[model samples]
Target chain A: MNDETLSAVDVRDAVKRYGDFTALKTISLSIKDNEFFTLLGPSGCGKTTLLRMIAGFEDVTEGAIFLYGDEIENLPPHQRPVNTVFQNYALFPQMTILDNVAFGVEMRGNSKAEARRRAGEMLELVQLSQFSSRKPSQLSGGQQQRVALARALAPEPKVLLLDEPLSALDLKLRKAMQLELKHLQRETGITFIFVTHDQEEALTMSDRIAVMSAGELQQLGAPTDIYERPHNMFVADFIGETNLLEVSVDKIAQGRATCHLGGGHELTCNQVDDIGVGAKVHMSIRPERLFMSDIPAEAESLKGTVKENIFAGTDITTIVALAEGPDFIVRTSNSDRGNKRIFEPGTEMYVNMEMGAGRLLVD
Target chain B: MAGGAASGGSATTDTYKDARGWLLMPAWSVLLVLSLAPVFMMLVYSFLTKEFRGGVIWEFSLAAYDQFFFDRGLFGDDPPVIEWTYLTIFWRSIWQAGAATILSLLIGFPTAYYIATRPENVRPVWLFLITIPYWVNLLIRTVSMKFLLRDQGPLNDLLMSTGLISEPIHIINTNLAVQLGLFYSYLPFMVLPIYAAVERYNFALSEAAADLYANKWVTLRRVLLPAVKPGVVAGCILVFVPSLGAFLAPDLLGGAKNFMIGSLIEEQFKGNAGNWPFGAAASMVLLTMVLIILLICARQQSKAGKEV
Candidate 1:
């Protein structure tokens, strides 16, 4: 075999600085071969900067990067084996679609005929074979995006960097392109490092995601690992919707802690590190995890008054006002809402939750 | 879009209301008086017979075109020979204008790119500096160039002082001086349009080019140049058309050694020849040439309308 391990892209303590303002802090991660990895964050979170560094557009200020298990920290963009699909789909306007797609291969010293043939195959792979002769200006936004993808893939790069390629499309088009991109990744088996701010897009396509914020990696895990068990408030709030309630630890034993909610409801939850008895901590709960009941079926249920009920097509959200804490939101599917009636305003009800629905965060 | 119709006016016609047609009358009348009437008069005068002095006779004649195309003996009885004099003058003018255009492009393209790449606030200062010399009259600038380029001027003095040359290089009253004057006169025309095009260029395309394995030079040749070609063509036309008909540069810097089209036409009307018909014919030919260049440029630009 091979002398190298499974890493397709390895970033080691990368740092990027412009004068004194650091755009990316020390970030290290190893992307597995053929894995659809994502760098997800809000705008200005240094996610695109990291992707640029991988594609060799931006120099690494302090650390090293390896591509396909070979060191490429000093390689220029043209010499590197990684290619990027730009956010705006920067297709050459003067060239036909086939020529635009063939450009990279021709630049790599391939014959014009060979590059053209390879480009034709790539266009067919993207289902744009009929548009090969048309200029990029003649194509629509979604079509140009596919052309950009085809152009980047024509080089047969070991690692493909996509910088928010689907953001320019309408919602329906974005959704369709998402599925197409996933299928493309599977068909090519190329290591895809996608950068996006859309968490839903990341969760839907990425095999694993690295969540970044303010130049630091907050968490890196699979979608369910991140959404079910967030390490901090930022990741929990960013990845998906969650309600954080402040609770004080009453007792701790056997890796479990007894906590008192702000409304004087006592509950026991799985313990988290760095918490002492009587210490205030944050508890996160997803809205879909909670249910409404007229009669208390469990002693741990919290009693509350119905504040407002909101209907949002597929799901109905019921807001519950506690005696001394923030309002609790309970979500149920409309089908479930048919089985369970929405309590009218000012009616007292018990809010029940299943086990592991509430997670204790250190911060 | 529907708001305009809801406002109770005829929105189907657009913002140019029917009543506003009267507002365009002053501009149209001025154009007809200043442009159309002069061109019409020139066309009529070009076909009429030339008088002894500067006036044109009402009788039509082919004498002006024949005089331009054929040369006669001193006694006016020899068989007509093809006259290459005016054609040579016109050819030289075209050559000089083409050289000046190329020279300005060589200098202005880099200057424009430099200014366009600067920080947003600092760019205006550089553009202002470029326009500062232009604000002064063109004649004054040409005269100043003559002063600076003369044999005993500061340029030769500085070169001699630096030990680069033992003897002062003679640049005054030569074709080189006229070319330099023309380049200086219209460099701004080249710089401004290219600056606008470069400013509007998407830098992401450059990055994408690099990602697609293009080095800096290849990216510029294949992508950047093609994207900004319309601006380059506009700059060329702006410089070349004006340079073709320019009289001041050749007169002031070229020392009147050879006849250019402008000077030949000037001689017919104002110099010793005083032939109004020949002057009008030369003017019509030059006007037609410039119009053809402009029409070709417009058709090519509209054929593509810009890539993106």
Candidate 2:
């Protein structure tokens, strides 16, 4: 967040290809020192390829990658001052936990005693000091993952690249490790680059997130900014639960555009570029941003029939069907218990979004 | 009481559901009989006396074994003592067989590794090529090598034409020719096991070794070789044991002067010895040596398997 933090990595127009198929189109991004950055995308979105290229495991077909002002595109993985925690943890089954953690330092030509000492310190940092003598096969999945992290960290690399490090873990362990990893990064004050497809994990863990789709970066911003002020409908829908209501702009004057939604509901909002009057548009609204009324309320409110009520632990997810098209989901918190109780399936409800809550995009 | 009784009956029925359950004891007894028959026969024959009429006399005598240990001649009543002839043949057989096994390994290991590292689409084709030699008869293959390496064969013609030699080389009747013949016949026996071991290998382990900072040689020494050593040992056994017992390759490729233990046993049985008891005794000695080799091999395998 601070400009004073050194730029640790600067990827310039990186392009990767495998034969005729292009895995990553030309893309550019920079990461600051000590920053926790994440590449969040679906499978085959080239996120892992991007991470591998940065880790020096993969060579870029085009473009250059600079580490702290030194071009390292041609360097092999071992020569780079970076280490990767592979997706499968990639722990050496033949080695004990202590030996696995000491591997990188040993590769760097350090004495066995020195590497072990530094590796033991890292294992202690990851709270795995007592597991030094045990082989990887003897440890639990979560413990092996910690050793993987400790192994990557033992070399004191300039950047620690993790390729879905916790993806192999069960739900409960993954959640716990997520917090521990953040704390570890904070304590160590080292740059961490994490890759994950889980949007929730990205939103919770990343200081800055790069959302990629179909081999191109769709959006890059801080977690809150990427979620709240997404550049397009794709980013908006992909980041979280959203209701995209098709609309048309009537007029755009100054910074505001008056739009008409389904069932003739008219609204006025700030105009985004490329959206014209009489042209098709969609207004994106987060579920919590929309309020539900038990009965018909006002002219600005739209009417829908409640189809299903899903009771999540703290919130109720109510799926509503409009007379026009696809159903919309509205999430109401437990504090609004009385209103949800009054609204049930087959009951008519009024949906209204606050003016500033929705993002207007031209389709 | 009814529920518990019903459950107990069902459990008993489940245990005896298959036909194998009924025949298990008989099958095990048959296997036991078949495996121990040779050792029993050998023990009995070892104690029998050899009569002048070439028949075994079951009168409890260790005289044949004593004569074998001390006698030097191939046959006759007043043979020379000190078994130098049999010892020389045994020593030569081992040296030749050992040479064959090591040479086969040197050629087989790299070929197997190369086949294993090939991409998925090409692996089957290479494996097929390695096995194609077996479709041709083994005797034909051995005899074909004779034609290829004889004094006037194409090999000597090429050497003479190239001026590398002034005359055709006499390689057909030597120990080196016998070893070469043994190696050519059994190299595939060494390859297939090591290939299977290398094929089942996970390339990910090699990558992990590299990531751990092991160079190519260290990775090969510490990780790759140990992973495939069992296969190597198994291949050596497959090549060595058969080569030691081989008579066809040596008979076809070398002169009668080059005799192995197998040829000696053949000579006593069907050649001038005309004594079946002495031939059986010689076979019994070969069998003892084979048992020792097999025991050492099995012990090594178990020790290696336990270390992991």
Candidate that would win on TM-score: 1
List, residue by residue over A243-281, the lDDT tens digit for candidate 1.
Answer: 788899999899888888876887777788877898888
Instruction: List the candidate 2 regions with Cα displacement exceeding 4 Å.
Output: A1-7, A274-279, A294-300, A323-326, A335-342, A361-363, B9-22, B25-43, B46-64, B67-84, B150-176, B254-259, B272-308
Runs of candidate 1 exceeding 4 Å displacement: A1-6, A334-344, B1-21, B51-53, B73-79, B162-166, B271-273, B302-308
Model 1 chain B scores worst on lDDT over the 10 consecutive residues at: B7-16
DockQ of each: 0.54, 0.31
lDDT of 2 by residue, A180-204 (tens): 9999899889899999999999999
* Candidate 2 i-RMS: 2.8
lDDT of each: 0.89, 0.83
Clashes of each: 0, 0
Tens digit per residue, CA lDDT, model 1, B1-308: 68866775656456677657888999999999999999999999999999977888999987887777778733367777888888888888898899999999999999999999999999999999999998899989999999999899999999999999999999987778878989999999999999999999998888888888899999999999988998899899999998888888888888877456887787788845599999899988899989998998888888866433
Give the least accurate 10-residue stretch of model 1 chain A, judged by summed lDDT: A1-10
